[model samples]
Each structure stands twice: as C-alpha cells, then as structure tokens.
Target: MTEPANIPSDALTTDVLIRHRREIVDLKQRIKNRRLQVLGLYGTPIVILAALITWAGLKVFVWLHSNTPDAIDNITGFVVFFSGVTFAVQAVAEFSKELSTRRDRKTPVRELKLELSLAEERHVLEARRRTPPPMDRQASYKERLPGEIARLRKESRHYRRIHLFMQWMLFINSAAISAVTAWYDPPQPAKGVLICLGFIVTLITAAAGYFKPRERAFNLQLTADSIEQNATALELGISPYDAVEEKRNLALFATTVEDLRAEQRMREQQLDQPQQGQQGQQEVI
Candidate 1:
C-alpha cells in the first residue's frame, strides 16, 4: 500500500486540547446561567401580566353571574390569589439576587484566586488520568462495520422509544383537557391543575417538534441499513467493491463506513443542543 503523507506540524498537544475543552465547558456553564437569569427577569413579569389578563376576563364572567358560586367565580378568585403570591415570590427572589450579587462583589480576591487554582488542579489531574481501551478492535472494515451497525440500531431504538412516549403524553393531555372542560365542569383547583397540565403538554410538544426525535431515529436506521448493505456486498464480492483490489477496497470501505458514522455523530450533537428555547420552557415549568 502507499504511505500517507503530510502530518501537520501545528497540531495541539493532548493536554492543551483537553484544557481547551474544559475551558469551553466552563464558558458554556457561565453563559447558561446568564441566559437563565435574563429570561427569569423578563418572563416573570410576562407571566404575571398573563395572569392579570386571565383574572380580568374571568371577572366579567363572575360579575355576569352576580357572585354565584359557579366555576367561573371559583376560577377568578383562584387566579387572583395565585397571581398575588407569584408576584410576591418573584419580588423576593429579585431582592435576594441583588443582595447575592453585592455579596459576590465583596468577596475577597484571594478567595477567587484560590478557586481558580483549584479548577486548574482539577483539570490537570483529569488530563493525566488514563482511559480504558475501547472494547472492540477496529483495525479492519470487517471488525468495525458490525459494531457501527449495532450502535446505530441501539441509538434508533432509544430515540424511537422517547418519541413514542412523548406522542402518548400529547394524546393523553389533549384528551384530559377536553374531558375536564366539556364533560365534568371540574372545580377551581382541578381546573387550575388541568391548565398546568396543558402548559406542560405544550412544552413537551414544542420540545418534540424542535428535536424531531422520530426523524433522527429514522435517519439512524437508514444509515445503518446502508452501511449494512455495503458491508454485505463487500463480504459477498458484489459489484463496485468487487471491481477493486481486495486490500485497497477494504481500506476504501472502512473510510466510507467511518465517514457515515461521523456524519451521524454530527447530526446527533446538533440535536443534543440545550439552547435558550429549551431553557425558557423549563422556566415556564
């Protein structure tokens, strides 16, 4: 076979690469905190405003019935009480946050230095630690292809199961909301709980739509099937791979399999992002 050429001279050492990754993790954690803080500052007021609007609309219903103990009266009273409590809690939290920020500023610089030093020590220790070797040998296409197929199939099953569960939740929540609103005329507390359930269902629906877990599963399965076909053809001396010399063809086949796996991995990482929208949804909860 031909020798591969041109190793890059500017490649980073393993320790430097790992340290960079650790720094990235730390940076992301800081950004996540700042984002959540901003969201909370903005969202609490919007939620309170929504509660007020809901309260006002329900008040008209109560007034029309002349303060009778109907569902609308109970619901209006409930919203007023809860909205007041929510506003109070948010106020207190904001006050506490201000105090905490002041305290953080007053903290000693020496303490900050110590914390930084400890973080560095932890990173160094982690970088020095040795990982266990991979269980499977991947020196050849024959060895690697089956492992890739198994891995892809497992991932597909995982995502498919999650997707199915979310689908069931969406259906069940929709049915429950319909039943409570139409048939039973549930009391105030039950109605409030149902509303929260509806919100949760909306959150789950949003998440499922954003992530497209079923689509991911389908893609993974498709890739696995394609790789399996290629592996089978190579094994059986079928066309394409059959035309090439055995050793060279095996190398080419391995490269193709790895490339496919890499593409799948990149897609998986994109799907895995815990960005602002998901974080905002969690705040709603």
Candidate 2:
C-alpha cells in the first residue's frame, strides 16, 4: 500500500486564504448592493415629490395668467392636495417596507460588515502563520503589482471623466445663458433663476479649479506608467535587472517598486495640500 503524497502546509494555507478572501469580497459586494437597494427605495419617493412639486408650480404659473383664475385655482388646489397626500402615503409605505425588510433579513448590513471584518482578520492571521521563501515572497509581490497598476489607472480614468463632465457643464450653461439673453425675453423670475444658474456654473468652475481633478488624473496615470515600466523591465531581466544575480535582482526589483509607491503617496499628499500650505512649505524648505 503506497502512501499518498502529503501536500505542503504552505500551499494548503495559501489555498485557504485565497478562498477566504473570495468570501470576503462576496460579502462586501452583497453589503454594497443592499445599501444601494435601501437608497433607491427611499430616494424614489423624494424624486417623485420633487417632480410633483415642479408640476404644481408650473400649473400655478399658468393659472395666474389664465382668464378664469378662480376656477383654475380650485383645480390647482385639488391637484396640489392630492399630490401631497400621495407623496406622504408613498413615503410612509417605503419607510415601513424598509423596516420590515430589516426585521426579516437574516443577516443585515451591519452583521455582514462584522462578518467581513472577522474574515479579514482571520485571513491576516493565516497569512502571518505561513513563512514563504524569499523567492516566493518576491513572486507574490510581483503578482500583486498588476492589480495595483489597474487600480491606479481606474482612479485616473474616473477623475479624468469627472473633469470632462464638469467642463462640459460649464460650457453648456454659459452657452444657454448667452442664447436666452440674446434672443428671448424671459420673465423677471425666470431671468433671476438663469442668473442663479450662471452663478452656480461659476462656483462649479472654481471648485474644479481648486480640486484639480485633471492634474490628479495625470499624476496617477504617470505613476502607474512608471511602475509598469519598471515591472516589465524587471520581468524581462533587462537594463537595471540584467546585471544583477537572480536573488539580488528580485530584491532590487522589490525595493524599487516600493520606492515608486512611496513617491506616489508623497505626490498625492502634496496634491491634497492647499495652495497656501504648499507655498508655506516651499518657503520653509
């Protein structure tokens, strides 16, 4: 009777940690979906209420301009009354449904978060127990580099998109205001509202300038690209890694990657500081 080959404890621990990590990810996604559901449930009524109020306002405006103002007033009053009552009923129903859902759910959001936290802690503990060889550690770190690169690029893309959207909004608002003022005679109240919108666009422009999303996106992309270039060079055993021995090359690659990440963090911190603070720091330096 030949004995089956025994699996390495390190491999078994790695496998367990991988599975546990997947479970944690699933829990996090579930929590996110549940929160979104709650938001939509409550938010729909508020959106409906806003739309109804806007419709009522437009009706009132038309009634004020109509010849049969009293009859229109009676109709508007009934519409407004029914709309308010409907909104209240819908709001109460949504609240009750949310409450009932909370009561019925076996694992609520808070419990799921707690479970996720515990799972993360267990993963950390298990990872700490297994001591990987130096080469294995280097390989593991290298494997994680791609994920980090992807995350940075994703953030860069997000910021870039936001910057573009804000710019377009500013342009469209300015053009609309110009066209309306040049060609159409609006009521005093409507003119005032348009002016307010212009002010809002100005504020939006100021905010975008202050936050510098475009610059942030550029910095993130640059950092990600630098890291990727170094990683590729290290993997292909070219340039910097070419002259070094295998273990030394791995160690150097790890150090270089870490230094790049630290520099990226520093850049992010600098970007986060206010202009005045940055100027003061520069003066001190």
* Candidate number of the best lDDT: 2
lDDT of 1 by residue, 122-223 (tens): 666754553212221223337756887898899899989989999999998898887777765555657786888799799999989788889899889988
Clashes of each: 0, 0
TM-score of each: 0.46, 0.63
**For this target, which candidate reaches the highest TM-score against the unseen true structure?**
2
Candidate 2 ranges with C-alpha deviation above 4 Å: 1-7, 22-121, 184-190
Instruction: Let me know the TM-score candidate 1 reaches against the reference structure.
Output: 0.46
Cα lDDT for residue 199, candidate 1: 99
Give stretches of model 1 more than 4 Å off: 1-139, 186-189, 272-285
How many angstroms is residue 271 displaced in model 1 relative to the true structure, after the best TM-score fit? 3.1
**C-alpha lDDT score of every prediction, in listed order:** 0.68, 0.78
Clashes in model 2: which pairs? none
